[model samples]
Target: MTQAEGGLRARKKRETRAALAEAALRLALEKGPDNVTVEEIAEAADVSVRTFFNYFPHKEHAILGRNPEHIERALDRMREAPAEESPLTTMRFIVHDVLRDLEGEGELSRRGELIMASPHLLYQLMLSSFEDERQLTEALAERMGEPATSVRPALIVSASGAACRVAMERHKADPDRPIRELVDEGFQLLAEGIDPGFRVVPTKGHP
Candidate 1:
């Protein structure tokens, strides 16, 4: 296809994906995920069910679409980042960049509200976060270009991942708050340090 045609096709695909996501979000918020069938979503999107499958591997995936890809894109964006940027800074770049995509369209806020409306969708978001974390850690490790077993890369990833998760959960709980401010707070908390025992706890009635 000519360059112009290729651009048009890309735009069409983006539109299709957006439409499907919007439909799924609306139905999820309106009826609940269990009640919203893939067929209904496809119909709402103005596409055949087959086209829906073509875009998303499963119904839940349609809701998680582009999230991981957004992280990968941010990772790619900093391929030539200056050496002066700390690992925390690089992670902040990725965090903000991924969020930028979401807020660029009211779609992020809408879909986020949808996820809150459905338990299944909330689980899907958690699963998506795990996958995205794995992909992101591995990408950062590879960028570090050191042994996978190295402590520095692992530590960087663990710290960043924990910080980011806290940031996300805070936003989910309060969409009205500034996402960037939350992320900064998360990273600051990391810098201040979490309690070593925070990851584990005693049984009830025990010290």
Candidate 2:
């Protein structure tokens, strides 16, 4: 096939995938996820069930609208980060940028609410979070010139994920506060090494 044909085909596939995901989320919000079916979502999106399955493995995935391509795009952005920046710093910037973009879209709260309302969806989201962490670990390893098997990369990625999760949870509690600000605060704590209740004793008579 010609390059133009391939490009057009890819764009059409993306449109179909997005339409299905949007339909799934809208239906779930309107009638609850437990009440929505793959057939219904496909019909709402004007696509066949077969096409929906091609984009999402199941109803939960469709409702969550988790796209693997998003991870690839994030990895690309991380790769473009300044060479002098530490991996954690690059990750912080990426997370902040991602949250800022989502804030603009105004769907984060609704998505969080939907996931929180569904136990099965929450479990699936946790599973996907682990996978994202693994992919991030590998990307950080490459960025830092370390072997993919290195423990440091995994530790960094896990810590970063934990920090971000905490930040998001706090944001959910008080959503009036800007999520990006909370994310920045979380990353700052991570940068500080998160010493557990450790306090330095002043040198005797030094002050």
Candidate 3:
């Protein structure tokens, strides 16, 4: 095939893969995740179930999606971040690069809300997290050129994850809020410092 024709073919494949993922997420939202089956998603996307399996190993894989290359790209950006930059700064730069294109995350965010609302979907997403965490940690370690068990990567990933989780919570509560602004708010909150007062309380009867 000519280079132009090959490029077009690759683009078409990407489009088809994206359509299948969108179909699966949509069905999961409309009828809850558990109700959506692989065959149903394939049919919705105008593809055979075999085609769906070619793109995704399972129904859950469609929901979680996969882009190891993208993660690697993000890590590459992180690696080149200023030497003196803190983890938060570096991670924000990396994550913003990944998320700024929108990457259809708004749709994913909506689907996430639906997933959270249903116990079944929540369970499914939870299962996906185990691998998600492993891969993320591995990426961080690779970027830092440190061992996976090192405290530096661990601390940085933890803080970054907390920021992301906070932003997602706010988005779920009020999606009208710009996600970037919400994420900024989380980082600001962390900057201002968190304090919890502690006191010993006496039993009312004893007092």
Candidate 4:
């Protein structure tokens, strides 16, 4: 195919994939996931069942649409990071970049809502998160010139992942508040040694 034609074809495929995912998420939200079917999702997206299958293995995957390509791209960025950058700075930049890229049209917030609404999706998200964490640790260790088994990379990944989780939870709780701001606050907390001082209030019945 000509370059122009190839570009058009790629755009079309992306649109189709997005349509299928949007349809699946919408239908799942309207009628519980258990009540939604692949055929219904295909019809909603105006694509054949075969086309849906070509993009995703099943309905739940379609609804979640957690793109493996996105993680690959993040790993690529990590691998190509500047030699002089510290591991923490590299991670902060990479995390913010991924968040901004994925937050298009508030899609991340919508996905957060869907995940919270469905137990199966939540479980899938947890699985995906673990995998992402594994890949990130490996890439980070390479960046740090250390082995994948190094405790330094693992600790950095665990701490940053915790920051991101808190940010996501805050976004889910108050979606109107910008997710980027929440994430920035999370990183700020980390920068401050995660020791923002506040005395704990004693419960009424227990001192």
Which 10-residue window in model 3 sums to the lowest lDDT? 189-198
Off by over 4 Å in 2: 100-106, 196-207
- Model 3: lDDT of residue 163: 73
Which is the better candidate, 1 or 2, if ranked by TM-score? 2
Q: Give the C-alpha lDDT of model 3.
A: 0.70
For model 1, state the Cα shift of residue 202 in Å.
15
Cα lDDT listed for each candidate: 0.73, 0.82, 0.70, 0.82
lDDT of 1 by residue, 1-207 (tens): 899999999889888988887787778768877788899999999999999988887788776455335765866855656677766678777777777777775666667556666778778777766666666666667777766666776676567766755665677898788767887888777767666456666889998
lDDT sort, best first = 2, 4, 1, 3
Flag regions of model 3 displaced more than 4 Å: 1-6, 101-106, 142-146, 191-207
Give per-residue CA lDDT, model 4, range 6-125, as digits (tens).
999989988898888888888988888789999999999999999999888888888887666668887988898888877777778878877876666346777777777778887877
Residue-level lDDT tens digits of model 2 in 1-207: 999999999999878877887888889999998999999999999988998889999999888877777778778877888898988887887676666655554566677678876888888988988998888888889988999999998988888777777766787788887667777787888788678688887898875
Stretches > 4 Å off in candidate 1? 172-176, 195-207
Q: Work out candidate 2's RMSD over C-alphas.
A: 5.5
User: Highest TM-score among the candidates is held by which one?
Assistant: 2
Residue lDDT tens for model 3, 173-203: 8989877787777666655554445466898
Model 4 Cα shift for residue 173 (angstroms):
2.6
